[model samples]
Target: MDVLISGASVAGPVLAYWLRRRGFFPVVVERTPRPRLGLGGHAVDLFEPAMEVASRMGLVSALREARTESELLVLERPGRPAAELRLNAVVPAFDDDKHVEILRGELATILHGVTRDDVEYRFGDSIRTLAEDATGVDVTFESGETRRFDLVVGADGLHSRVRELVFGPESEFRHDLGGYFAVFSLPNYRRLVGKIVLHLGVNRMAAVYPVRQTKDARAVLMFRSDTTSQHDHRDVAAQRELVRKTYAGQEWELPRLLAAMDDADDFYLDTISQIRMPSWSRGRVVLVGDAGYSPGPAVGGGTTLAMVAAYVLAHALEEADGDHANAFAVYESRIRDYMRLCRDAAPRVLRNGVPRNRVHRAIAETSLRLLPRLPDRVRSRILAGGISGALSSFALPE
Candidate 1:
């Protein structure tokens, strides 16, 4: 079978790897001109299942070496002493060997490298239109080339062009989680080494964490908004201004972070939204990862879910002997429940992370401060019932 997958960052490449391993020819179309090599993006977590998938793909060693050594987390409030805690205290799952944390760009580069030789990657091009028929999918590229494929998979992220073309408008499937965020890299002015400093204010927060080397650091700024107001998703200048306006005149490194955000080269801002769909497939076309169901960014184990979804998709296709109908059905059935569990937690997390008022902020801080001191069994029970547990709910098909 000849399969065309869109958006090569994480899901596309992983899907390509598994499909090729299943004796299927895979072609990947990425909008970016080239692979992101050590670019600045937030560090993402991989739990038990994603780690298992990496092991199967022969990428465990490389990923282990790429893991971020974030040792401490410092939470600061206005006119208050900064609270210090171990990074694993806030995220207890990381204390175990099953959870791995690495930079997003680094993970993308690794996945692309592992599959580049086997997969046909068309960079600097994208599908302008997709016409699906009983036999195959006829795709037209932005560069004005046309091709037909046995199947088309949309691995694109939240604002997926493939999903828009095949499924519907993004607004139809997008569920606003009531916030916005921006991520960028800056000079390590504070010289933070294996430490993360977070500053929280009413309805906003800033997090600065050291990167692989102590020379540079990654900054994340998040703010809460009440309404799902529309903004240009592609306008960099506009997005920057929005961030600047929203975070104007805050305390604890706000001015410096804002300055760095303006000067930073790789500034990316997006609304924190989830993609909820009734079905992830339609005839010969199907969706994978954030393209189909994104339980918001940052929270929800999105990257891990994307990798496992790609693995399940390949196995389903192979098991069904290229019957896309059966394959897509099984793929959705296997992942729908887990995806829902992840999505359901997004709002609660968003509210807690970006508190609306002082009361909420205090409650959030108190919970964080007390989480580590909880009895091991109580914490285990809580983790098992929360988003972290939903991450490893599915076992891969052998």
Candidate 2:
């Protein structure tokens, strides 16, 4: 079967890899000129299970070798070392020894490289119109090129064009979680040690971590600015100014961090919201990753979810005898429970990131205080339950 996939990021290439392994041909159309170079993609905590999946795809070594060098430091109370717990300490679910973070573009590059031999990649192109019929789908690209496929999937992003075309408007699907976040690269002004330092408050907070070297690092600031309007999604200059204005008088290293912000080549700005889709698949086209079901920005295991989705969808097709519809259904059925949990875990940040008042700060502090005492063994069990079955069958079709 010939399948068409949009968005060549995490999910698209992984799906293409699995589908090609399953004896299907996939053509991926990405809406970018080339590998995104200057786009400042955020750092993601790639988990052990995810690493296991990457190993299966044969890209684990590259990911580890190219991982962004980082140091993670937790800041609970300002001067108290005892109050500080590592981010990994917050949830003992993952084994950090195997967990490493690479830039989003780096991972996409690796995934694309791994699958390029078997899958066709069409960059600087996107699906403009999609019409579905019983047998397959007729896809129209922006360049006036038309093609037909056995199935179509949208792994685009949070503002998935396929979801809009296949499902509906963005407002009908996304639920604004009253938090806004912007991630950007800052020239290593503070000469910050390679560590994640959290400056916490009630409803507002900022974090600065060493992304690469003291010369080049990434800074991300999140606050409860639900009403803060972002003028343009692609406007980097304005977004930098927004960061400067929002935390003007803010103490800690944020001021020094923002001072170096304007020099960044790429700065990203967006809201902390989740895409709550009733169904990820509709007719012959389905959505994956942030396109279909984004559990807010970086809450739960979203990257893990996308990887698992790709694997599941491909396996379902292999098992269902190339029946794309049944393949999608089986994929959804297999991962729904884990999907629910991922979605739930994402919004759990409301209690932490959002505050009803100053009292909520106390709650956040309390959660941090109780974090260390929580049993790791028990947490590991929960992690096992959450991530186990989703990627259980890593085997390809014989």
Candidate 3:
């Protein structure tokens, strides 16, 4: 079968890899002009199941070597002494042999490296329109080229063009969680080595961690808003202004972090939202990863979910012997409950991570401070019930 997968970041490549391994030809279309190798983004966690998938693909060692190696976390509050904690203790799952946290770009580069030689990648292009018939999908590219494929997979992210073209407008399915997340790279002036520094405030948080294998660091700023912004996601200047206005006069390295944005080349800003859909497939077209069912960005384990979903999708297709109807049905059935759990848990995760008031912030801090001192069994239970557990809850098909 000839399959055209949109978006080459995470799900597309993984789906392409597994599909090719199962005797199918997969072509990937990416909007970026070139591959995003080493173009640093946010740090993403890979839970047990994702790690197992990596192990199966012989990428565990490489992923481990590329991990951010953040050993310590420093929590800073204005007019209060900074509290220090071991990063692994803060999230015990990070200490587990099954979990690895790496830069998003690095993970993408690694995944692409394994699939490039075997897959056809068309960079600097995207689907302009998708016309699906009983036999195949006719895809028109923005560059004006047209092609037909037996199947078209929309692995494109939250604002997926493919999904918009087929499923309707994004706003129809996107449920805004009332927050924004922005990240960019800057010089490692703080000289933070193997450490992550978080500046917490009511309704807002800023964090910086060093990028492995470079003298650079990544700055992440998040804030809650009453309503979702109407700004275009691609408007960099407008996004920067929004961030600046939201974070203006903040304390503890925020001024410097905002200043550093002037020189930051890879700025990304998006609403923290979830994609909820009744169906992920229509005829010869289907959606995967963030394109179909993103719980929420940053707060949710989106990276891990994307990986596992892609793996399941390719496995389902192979098991069904190229019967996309059966395969898409199986794929949705296998992951729907897991997706629901993630989606339902996301609001609480966001509320905890970005406290709305002083009381909430204090409660969150106290919980973190007490988490490590708990008994081993108690800590394990807590980890199993929290975001870590929800992310790793899925059982991959044999």
Candidate 4:
């Protein structure tokens, strides 16, 4: 079977990796021109099973090569030394290292490398049009090549072109979580000690954390904003201005982060939105990762969920004797519970971070300081619950 995957970042390459191992021919199309991303930064929580999936692919050692050190807890101010919350415990079910954090770009790069030899990757190009029928989907790319494939899975992203062509416009499936998010790299010039700093506000917040293995700190700026309006994604100048206006008069290092935004080589600005789709698959074409059902950003274990979903989808297909439709159904059925937990976790976390008032912010900070005082076993149990809540429900086929 010939499978066409859109987006080479995380889901596309990962799905290709498993699809190829299952004896399916996979071709990946990416818009970026050879992404040279680095590892060792911004810790991402990979559940035990997510790690197992990587280990099964023989990429665990490679993943370890990119593991960013985890040492820091958030505070309410910069260098206040008022109070600090220690990272109490990391939840690992049945194993201590079951859940580990790695940089997002690092995971994408490694998933790409593992799939490169066997997968057909078309970088710097994209599918211009896709028309799917009962037999297969016909695709035409920017390079003017046309082909038909047995399956088409869109791993593109929140703004999936495939979803637009098949399911309708993006507006129908996208649900804004009432926030705007921006991230950029700032020099360790702040010399932020070994800790993450977060200044909370009503419907807004700012945070800073040192990226591991480099003196640079990754700054995140987020605030609740109206989204009845839209902006051109390609217009960089407009987006920066938007960020500047939205975050104006904010305290914390927001001013400095915005100053770095002009010369920022790679800054990402997007509304915190969730992808709500009734079905992730249509005919032989399916959707994965943020393209399908993003439980909003940063809140839920979305990164873990995306990788696990691809693995289960491929496994179900392998076990289903080519019944692609049944395979797709089973894929969703298996992971639905886990996805629910990730989705449900948002309200509490959002309330804590983007508080409704200063009181909530102060209360949220108090909880963090109290965390370290809990018994080690109690924290471990909570960690287990956290992992189980986020990922334990999905059972992999032997």
Best candidate, lDDT: 3
Which stretches of model 2 miss by more than 4 angstroms?
Answer: 37-40, 68-98, 228-232, 235-238, 354-356, 366-370, 373-398
Candidate 4 weakest ten by summed lDDT: 87-96
Which wins on TM-score, candidate 1 or candidate 3?
A: 3
lDDT of every model, 2 decimals:
0.87, 0.72, 0.90, 0.76
Compose the digit string of candidate 1's lDDT tens values, residues 264-360: 8889888899998999999999999999999988867899999999999999999999789999999999988878988887776677788889898
Error of 1 at 11 (Å): 0.9
Best by TM-score: 3
lDDT of 2 by residue, 6-81 (tens): 8888989889998888788999999888855432478776665567667787877787777765544666445656
Cα lDDT over the full model 2? 0.72
Candidate 4, 98-174: lDDT as tens digits: 65667787888888778888899998888889887878889999899999999999988888888887788888998
Q: Which stretches of candidate 1 lie over 4 Å from their true place?
A: 93-96
Candidate 3 residue pairs that clash? none
Error of 2 at 338 (Å): 0.9
Q: How do the predictions measure up, each by TM-score?
A: 0.97, 0.86, 0.98, 0.91
Screening candidate 1 with a backbone cut-off below 3 angstroms (N, C-alpha, C), the clashing residue pairs are none
Model 4 lDDT, full chain set:
0.76
lDDT of 4 at 12: 83
User: Backbone clashes per model, in order?
Assistant: 0, 3, 0, 0
